[model samples]
Target: MKVITKILLCFFFTTIFFSVHIKAIEEEQSIIIEVEGDPHKHRQYIEDYHPLIEVVQVYDTIFTGIALKGKASNLERMGSLHFVKKSYPVRTYQTNINRSVPFLTETDDIDTEQMKFTGKGVKVGVIDTGVDYSHPDLSANYKGGYDLVDLDDDPMETLPEQGEPTLHGTHVSGIIAASGNMKGIAPEADLYGYRALGPGGRGTSIQVIAAIEKAVKDGMDVINMSLGNTVNGPDWPTSIAVNHAVDRGVSIVIANGNSGPANWTVGSPATSPKAVSVGASTPPMKIPFLEDSFEDKRIELAPLAGSKPWDLEKEYPLIDGGLGEEELPNARGKVVIMERGIVPFSEKARKAAEAGANALIIYNNEEGILQGSLDDSQGPIDIPVAAVGKKDGQWLMDHVTEGEYWIDTTYQNIQDKIADFSSRGPVTTNWNIKPEIVAPGAAIVSTVPGGYRELQGTSMASPHVAGGLALVKQAHPDWKPEQLKGALLTTALPLKNGKGLYNPIDQGMGRMQPQAAIDTETIIYNPMLAFGKIDKLKDSQTVDVKIENVSKETKTYHFELPQNTHGLSWQLPKSFTLEPGDKKNVSIQLSVISNMMDKGLHQGWITLKAKDTSYQLPYLFINREADYPKAMGLEFALKTFSKEEYEYRIYLPEEAKSVTIDLYDPHSLVFQKTLVTLEDTEAGVIEGTLKKRNITENGEFIANVEVKTTEDKTYNYQTVLSIE
Candidate 1:
């Protein structure tokens, strides 16, 4: 009888110990709590919770919230508090810069030197990985700023000793207002750096929001954010902060993102309605293409950064290099073709170069063409590297297997073409057309930490517009933020793809034309018409467009009929005249016959004739429920305060009946196991935690997510997940 009692006591003690331990682990989660009243007043209340939640920071300017660390169960309980409005999981953001000035200025037609619009007396803030204000070109224009990471006034770029050093913000600032030997678009604009992202160019959404509020408090006329995350929702926290900043009279510019060449890839901050999101376009350059020996096939090559340029004129034998993660088959004096996965692009290039390969081509594992860069940390790769689409790579691989295949290079003098890396979008939920405009982003030479360096991305494209807005602001100090944004969009030059002009989602109004924007007298607000999703067979939508005559003379406007489509019809306003300084709002209606038209996204341009020039306003609408990705922005990582637990977050476009994430070996592509499975997941961000004991292994994995929507539709998405 004593032995039985001892056994029961031992069992009870073990159960109690584990319950307390689990509770301790669960209390380490961090989230941002938005409250109904002032966040400062509610801090004590949050800290006094049963589990003892810690208030990290209180925000009152741009966002009324408090960042706190506590148990998820307590977080839900706090949500029930009358003062608590909502809560958001802290999401991380990463740095996402330069350009030829003459290409955008149209110097031949309008001499900027003669015009003397140098953006003097305008304050422009760059919120990125901080800046090297000591650079010779940027020193004179460098104004004081703050560092959110360190909570100080010294907003310098991350140093080597501090962590991973960064030059991204310096490059972006130079593009806006470099005052030395290399002149930027607006050389005289006052430049300030907000160090939101710290070491390794990484920062959380809270830091970003804090930086925006700081910039606004400093009374910055314009702000540029070259950093973004993979969340596509328009209502994300950072995006909402952007809208609020714009409402406060600050002109905000954001990089559309680099996850592109595919539709619906534009991420947060860029998805903000009031922000001017910029995309990438190439300046005048020689683009390389590979042709087969028989001249039967040709494929475009997007050269990777930090590698030798593709200048091979002679035909070279092509050999498949698998994933380039392992040993290569005799590739001496030949071109190596590798698939993109497992290892970094720089690692693959290093292996190929060691194998005496003349060149390297890494193809995408997914549908679209790959736009990649070699890691600078791995050192320079001697051989030239380029990327191609999966289909083209597979074709080359098939030909290589059949027999020996040789390829020769040809060059196309391409300019104003959309860079494949520039993210595209008709933002989810709101279905708004993003990337309000494109700018020169490819091979832009600007200021780095030490000297000048050439970098490329939508990051470089954003500063060009920011600088242009500065010039506009200097030229018309009376104009509001909306007018400045509208001026750029209405005057942009439309860009063309292989089929025709690139869609609004791809290129927006088109590449930025600063000279035209400065000289234009008419500005059209809400130029890109997004009719959203049409579910009914006979659906009609009306959009309000505001037109302002900024020119000195009276101007008359009339809309030309759009191309005749079977199921689409339009109602345009009658010809109307607006005198100088006059503004009017006009309603344009679109009627859709869904049964007669094809289902999916439909977009085109509507012409509006104003005086001698004709303006093309982009229009977009979906016939029925469009087939956008069901899941995206999947992220998994170990908890910051608890190593024994792992957390994950994913964005779902619609309510899903079930969501499953399957893990696969990066190299072998074999199924490992189901990493996560959930039922009845709602739309928006779904976040959860898993015990470390549940995982079989910890390493890098290729996560293939299958989401079944409540409507019985299934969609798949692929991403890389790493755990330690």
Candidate 2:
């Protein structure tokens, strides 16, 4: 989300072979990479390589003079040369790459028509802070809990904050098993609350693992984890624990991180194959309305009768138009009228006094009055500063038109309008596609310890999906975690956001449609077959294939592969055949160069490719494991997102002719490696576009954009992308 910039953000690559003609201009000084190999020695060139910038050319290979990152330093290797195979390179886009927030809504939307109709007698578990055991809506569903964080067997005691009260866990528990009047997805399911994080929303990896262990031991049908760390590397302990948990029948739903940047790759348990990840979506929004009351503490303690009069002493002057007149003309030591805006309530009061106004009355920009100020707290403003709902503001506007007084030195709001700062997606950084099957979030009226809390976040969205999974599991107690996850993925419905539509990269197989997944009657296969060589032809450039089923049921399907127009060129047949539980590998072979096309994102999914198709088996995302710094750029002008777009230009110094740019998603290469044309510019200002793409897979994708100066000097830059 767009956090205040002041907070140090804890928000937490490819080849192509092309010739270049650089008419050397002047001496250059940049890191140079010179590859020397026998020009005529084909296979030898691919196998042997070295970085020769300052060292003498010792190898028996041609010095394809220093590629300042791959551009031509000298204009010579211009005319195209023919050969059997050539290494492909990646295309480059602007360093401003896209990202996705991979998550699920745990639904059965696509084929809701066929799902088994029944509420299985199954209970689920929410391994979080704790649950609100006594609320009208969720009270009947609150089964029980344990405090994993405090190491307590009692789920009720989350922390000392409640003097034997806990909030986080209770809320989570309610989401999962809270049944009766107000319903949860698995209304029949019981709950085992494991408070991992304390009341402050803080917890370690150890605590989370502990919660998982407890849930598994307690026979929890489903476990939901809605929190995560920004740093995700190979050595995360949560991963190890969840992998073990998966071995058992217990299913898990983990939340993808909310912190953006460094493309907060899926952390710990969420990255685990069996852990179903739930990403956040924008909270439902409606125009703000003027109100007189709400459920928050601030609104509860409103003045019943006559309260203290507005104190004018501490009022400070606001900018040019303080509450006085030249302004208002008739108003003096009276209450001032202000629009709901940036300044704090205290500041507004101070400003009114500075202008000789006694009281402060502010209204929201929308139709009615707002319940409370998102920034309102106690103490700053000396004079009384009160707000009215949006409707009141409209009335004030209407009053002014009628030549009547418009000041109401009072604050009133009934229902609280949801705050808009709540983060939305297609997740901007991680690959979270949209529209995430939105469950309740934003001022959601849910159960709490003393009473209830109107909380919001992906955290809320997570438990809803978790609760739904409980129902799915209850229905198919025999299904494996993979089966459950596949159902969620395969039966998802794709949605559109500001950035086009959600893709696998961003939304991860689309938003979970529980009912659809539950009702699906057929299988849609997108298998990654390990096809062995079939034909041995003399220098054959192509090969054929077939399919066999190794499943318990007989099946027929169609196949499709990603477009391979680059170096590694190949395609598959449209149709294939299979039988019950048979071993069948499609036959396909090719004699292509290793570096075929540009390095970036590439996919190959096999599906029914037909109308009324069913059963889709998704292969994993294209991103591979790679290591990079876990921390960088925390202290910068990083806002949630900028409505204002920007442009950038990288000019190649005259000494450099062509430039090669590579985009990466973390250490993994993303889009096609692009080598842009930068010649004929006396003043350097190359153009680049930040185009958005729609994909539908789940994984953290990054692009490493590099530039090579004509003199062989190279520079590398990495950035995050989002195209759900």
Candidate 3:
């Protein structure tokens, strides 16, 4: 009896320990980890987690996907990794998300009527190689071109232009305002040129800056800078130049970059705050996965994982061979994968030729592999070479796709989301936040530095935003870069940033929604421009327009400052023009400060205005703001919301320091009206809270917040009231 009892006790204790171990894992949040980049990296990462979490393997380099154990469903809507969207008229985009629609090629990606650029003579500058004047789709709209590279006539490349025909500049120009059968968002708009990058997509920040300077000087509405740099330095000329451009009323769009895993990283030019940054997004559709055997080819042109060569495309052919057969078995017209460092990737290609291979796949020595091309410095070799990670290489070894495989060959590069490769943001370096938005990067079909081709990277994504910016510009030509920036940022829709539970450093602010930004109803700072009024703004300079969102909610709208003003000088605007509750920024600049002498006395008062509220600045007739304290504090009480979302009430106690509230008055503190809650458990209550709180503020002031459901509907109740 004693022995049996002891055995039972041991079993019970063992059960308890197992239960505790299981519980610990369940409670832990998802974490990102870096391990060896080998073919077994993913397996090794999750090897110990067996019975804890089940994984759906997609690639060899893939360690782990996002953890969905307890995340929101909306955030986990990955399309390509799940379902795929149908191809757009141009091409199909694969995504794990089901609800996301494909590109606008077939079904309108955006409301065509909203474009508003029909007759508007706007010019979107493409600061690439140059615009192509010959492509069937882009010919008619080719206004004229300039080559910043050679600084000569015909920015367009000739037949002998050192690069591929795709570098003609027509493809990129088309994406901006493709005038062919498939209408571009900015159709009917003029195409401007500024050749920055050269063949094979290489250019300097100085050249890019020079292009922007020229575009601004020529008064182009939008300048498209669809290239970037991975490394950062003390002096970022691109960012500095961008600030000046915004101040000058020109909007610049820059590409993020192609490199991967760069947390908080963004491509140059795009990282510039004064410019709009763009990332990549997959096509919201299901498409074929184009694949060919690498072992059949002699040259490496696929990603590094494609270690072997295969014959499939038929476009390329093998000249020699082995294996005791008439020709090498896998050495015909297919991309090959070769290992780098073993006598150089290019030299390996030459060796493969002697062995009867047509293509080469050169992967990296790192635990994982990568895909990139080698320059022409090596001995003569003419075949496509592809690089990949070590892990991907091993996977390719297993899934050799045979002689031919169903692949979306037309599809772009690896849709693998990364951090270190993404542009870094909140960069104190340039004093600006970058990568304002993200999109699909791989296999990107956009304008190439030289011309037309499917180049992948954040480089392709930036042009999309620039084109969108042009469309926005057409709608509001008077909008200063500040106004446009505000609408884009505040109105951007939040989505899964990366493979992590939260936004991976790679995914900046969030995915940009072109339509949503243009239609939101909340009010951020509302500043009105008065050319030469009370403030005595310089006759030719821009007037600083200070605007702030006292409301504790997101707002979006279109704004425009006159572009005709000459000699304009004002800190154009903060890289982040839009603000949240209480944040403030200089709205406009009055160039009259001949010396710092007129700085203090210049009196051009910018009237604050918004499209949706009673938030308006009347003629200076209501300027009693001088009588009140610099700021007013709201000390009222109310109910609080307790659900996932919280709503509270604030009542302005009936004090008469001042009756009205104004945002512009130096002495009058403004309260964000949207945050004012009207909910009270009882039928009557006086509840108010200061919308913009600052610990450094002193003295006291009073502000009146009027609540209105509609423009003409105003409910004025000074007495106690219930906030139901």
lDDT tens digits, residues 677-724, model 1?
999987888888899999877787667788987878777777767666
Worst 10 residues of 2 by lDDT: 93-102
* Per-prediction TM-score to the true structure, in the order listed: 0.82, 0.50, 0.47
Cα RMSD to the true fold for all candidates: 8.8, 20.2, 27.9
Candidate 2: tens digits of C-alpha lDDT, residues 225-338: 776643233223465567677678777777654432123344444545446666544333322222222321122111101123233333232222232223444335665656
Per-residue lDDT of 79-145 in model 3, one digit per residue for the tens? 2222222111110001000111124222354554544343247777878766666666566666775
Candidate 2's TM-score: 0.50
Whole-model alpha-carbon lDDT for candidate 1 = 0.83
Number of the top lDDT candidate: 1
Please give the lDDT score for candidate 3: 0.42
C-alpha lDDT of residue 645 in model 3: 22
Scored by lDDT, model 2 comes in at 0.42
lDDT score of residue 473 within candidate 1: 92
Clashing pairs in 1: 97-460
